[model samples]
Target chain A: MTTTTKNNEPIITVRGLRNTFGEQVIHENLDLDVRRGEILGVVGGSGTGKSVLMRSIIGLQTPDDGEIEVLGESMIGRSEDEAKNIRRRWGILFQNGALFSTLTVAENVEVPIREYFPYIRPPVIDEIASYKIAMSGLPANAGPKYPSELSGGMRKRAGLARALALDPELLFLDEPTAGLDPIGAAAFDELIASLQKRLDLTVFLITHDLDTLITICDRVAVLADRKVIAVDTIPNLLALDHPWIQEYFNGPRGRTAALSHKEGAAA
Target chain B: MAANGAGKARSSGVLPTEFISRTTSRDMADVNGTSDDHQGESVYRVAGALTITRAATTQREIDALPDPLTIDLSEIDRMDTVGAWLVYRAVRDRGAKVVGASRDEVSLLHQVSEFDVPARVRPEESSSFTRVLTELGEWVADAGSTLLGLLGFFGATLIGFANLIRRPKRFRVNAVVQRFDVVGVRALGIIGLMSFLIGIVIAQQGSVQLEQFGAEVYTINLIGRITVRELGTLMTAIMVAGRSGSAFAAQLGTMKITEEIDAMRTIGVSPIEALVIPRMIAAVIMMPLLAFWAMLMALLGGGIFVWLSLEIPPLTYVQRLQEVTPITDLWIGLIKAPVFGFIIALAGCFQGMLVQGNSEEVGLRTTTAVVQSIFLVIVLDAVFAVFFSSIGWR
Candidate 1:
């Protein structure tokens, strides 16, 4: 896996993105870019179009009005095979870790690996599957267990392993720590940070958790009024004059932000 | 008493007894002023314009109120917080001291009225056993009804499969091959063991009966006829229903729950192409092969039992088998296999795609798929049997 950082280049760029359901406009002229090797945390209150933005960028949701370019290829109006091919360049960690329930953890990790790289020997696939599982911070023995037997956090790790199976250049996570307790959420955040560093992955994370944003994200994009109100480092984002932003960054949330930055700085 | 007059004097403004009587409505105040109006004592009433407040505030007022205070609400034509809470609190906080509290008063008083407040007069929780059994009964009934509906769906699927020979695209070899891996390849060990045991039981029973008739050689025919005509098709269908049918429901159900189908739509991936086509193809291919495997096991099991009990040589057994059945018999069985396969796969995947609930719906649809697939296979077999017999093929 290549670890060279491409900080100046934008791997994913969205211009004037918009999506509406019924009378509720989820996104209105939203514009953002996920730069190479940067962890961008997309944050907003519920219904502020965080997940919608991520989905649109990943070509999982069609934008009503926008141009999306990933890996310099236009994502709109692509063929199914083309879309799948584009998808191969990126990885997604679903909110609930949408692991295949019928498969064991090892087989779950092996899905993308086998689907995309079927020529690899079975023993090598097993080895790769086991390595990815361990990389996600799960025990080696966890690979043989079905999804039902594993705990919530374990399922998430297994899901992350699957996402990382293709060694994606860009990774998208939706509410990755949604239901986990503080301890679990913190550990997951660490795993994400380590993976990002080791694999040189550009992560676009959507989360409501202030702690996660403060602790892990290199840049935070605050979505409000159907577009990004601010996009900068957590400290700079906190310095915005918007009342809601001020309250968000200066209150309990801001403390989490400061703590996370400190930890990152210390690390 | 004399205190009644003083009580009127202590209020915000002291009013004459006659003035108070005129101000308070007939319903608001105890008209008769009889303390012993109800079987219970302490009938409390509030008379004035009323508004509502929270239960906690009501409790505070009730605690401050004197015992046996008769709250006359009829006089409260335009009651506000004072009248509503004072009356409600008296009833809730002071059981004997509060009485005649109406629903309107309570509704107006409780701040968080959405919750269950004011415990039942006779508070008694249900026993665990009764509660458990009641839940169990509901679950079982729900499961049973869902299974029945699934079976009906499977029956319809079988009819479609039978018609597939007329339209080859409906049951393509590639599709069948894919399903063969899922339903047949994946399920070999389980199906083989089950059929093998069932075959042994059938042979043992046939041997006992044939021995009584002093003609054990015909036991071979009995085994062949039973295995090929019914058990092979029926058992394979059942196994597929239990294994593949439920799998489809769960796979589809999880995707449905996760909004993956929606995701696919956004990415321009046809859900039918991405999900249904692959599973359908797999089922179409696997069913016949599984049936073939099951038939061979059943025969092997029966052959072993006959060779041991009847002392019939293996060659003699093979010769006896040739006398009763033929390649056409195998073809008939093979024909039913794919039809059964399509039914189980279609029923399972269809039911799976139909899943709506959370994880709970997956288990529900799975059971439904299995039952529906099996039922449809059997019904289709019966129709085929009659149709083939009438045409003189059987």
Candidate 2:
């Protein structure tokens, strides 16, 4: 929780990362840094390797060539035991929630806690899961429901609860608000912001939602031309001359998002 | 309270030493120093950070203390939500009063307490005997419904065929041809090998049994009659059930899951006509041909086995096979082949169309398709046997 001491250090640093599938190169010489305790929103066109970059950093996909350092530890070529120790420090929420279909929500939340901290008793684990479920804005009864029984929005919240189970210092969320209605998306944005502040989590969020980027992200990283074109605040990014960036943040949806955010702040 | 005491007793005895050391060394908390104040109430002072890592040990320590306790959190430097939850549970369940919690800790404790409603972890289960009876009842109902559903599917397939006859241009010739390749052409190698081996076995075993009667030459009659009348179509049906039947279920099941079938429906395309009819046509036409091929291969195999082992000439073996095997046997086998194909395709498509919800259903329906079709084929084979014998075809 020593946020001040680590405030300037980058929690994730990628250098000269290159990824290719057959002949299609998704990323090449891509470099980016995620600072500590910041919600870094990564935006890119489809097929520009936004997910690929996230996958590479999370060790799900091996890069053809690059250096990835997370939490000051080199992430490449690490043994399974070494990788597991680092993996326990972060949690990821995939786009589709990816909740285990068989287990109930409470049991899903307990999976990581039981795996890592087996000494914690079941009742305590249950209590922790309940609170996490509530904190993610789900009703108490959602803890008993299976993933298939829950709607898409509730499933995402359950996924969020499970991701927060370990009280992870870092979180990776892929399209957390992709399919939600506007109000739900806004509420989700606020929830993530509050959780980030309360838990001192450094968030690596991959999203296409302009509202989320405008409302919560401390800085935005733009992916284009097979690499990150720019990483800056929304206002700073708006000042850039890149056509894709200009069109993206000043598009009709983007303007509406910015206007609503301003109105929200004023109100 | 009694349960808490027992839990503490068991946990404390079996608690790993490393866990205790890890918790205490980093976020060390002293649970001692119970004092009696002027009000005559016991005070439990918890020191250092209380987090999830130390949750088990902390809960145990709190459970062991006497009732009407005052929890002192003034000395704690840091606390997370898990820590707050533990403190909240202790206060709520044991009626402990907080002495000096920070404003943030109090808010966190309140937040955690607001969500503390009883939620069931798993569904309630009845007694084992009742559960078994209930499962048996459900299975019977399911089987009954499945049989009706299969009949409905067969009716729909027949209607689709009638429509195709009315509008011959609408018939999916390409799809049926593709299915022909998959269900028939690709199956020749395995079916040929299996029938050949079975033919050799029958010839070898028949010769041994007939040797005692000094009628070893009658092995040709056994091989020809059995292969042509029973094993040829029967084995082909079982193999096709395992191969093409399972594939039809899986393909259609996946299509249903992904909403491809629904997409076709919205586009005014009947999935029964587009997907099921082609497969049915291919299976029906290919089955008889494949069965005839299997019979020929078996006879050739038997001919080879007799020539090698019994020193019977190939021409003599062929002549014996023709004389001993009646045309009626081949007729029965061919007539049964299409019927078996129809049942296999119907079961496959029926199970597939029934699939809904998850990808797991595809696997389950595929297995059902194979088992149900094979079972029905055997049952029908028996019925066919009885009918043919009553007609004196035996």
Candidate with maximal TM-score: 2
**Local lDDT at B148 for model 2:** 89
Q: Write the per-residue lDDT of candidate 2 for residues B276-297, one digit (tens) a residue.
A: 9999999999999999989988
Residues B285-358 of candidate 1 have per-residue lDDT tens digits of: 77777888899899888888888877887788788888897666777788888777777777878788778745
- Return the interface RMSD of model 1: 32.8
True contacts kept of each: 0.00, 0.29
Error of 2 at A24 (Å): 0.6
Error of 2 at A242 (Å): 0.5
- In terms of DockQ, which candidate is strongest? 2
Q: lDDT by residue for model 1 over A1-267, one digit each (tens)?
A: 122435478888888999998899998888888787889998887889888888888777888898999978889999989888777767899887898877788888888867875655554456556666766888767877777778888888888988877667688899899889989999999989877764567899998778788778889888999998888987687667888788777887577667776887899
Q: List the residue pairs that clash in candidate 2.
A: none
Maximum-lDDT candidate: 2
The digit string of per-residue lDDT tens for model 2 on A1-267 reads: 244233569999999999999999999999999998899999999989899899999999999999999988999999999998888878899998899988999899989999988988888888888888888999888888889798889999999999988878789999999999998999999999988866668899999999999999999999999999999999999999999998998999899999998998999
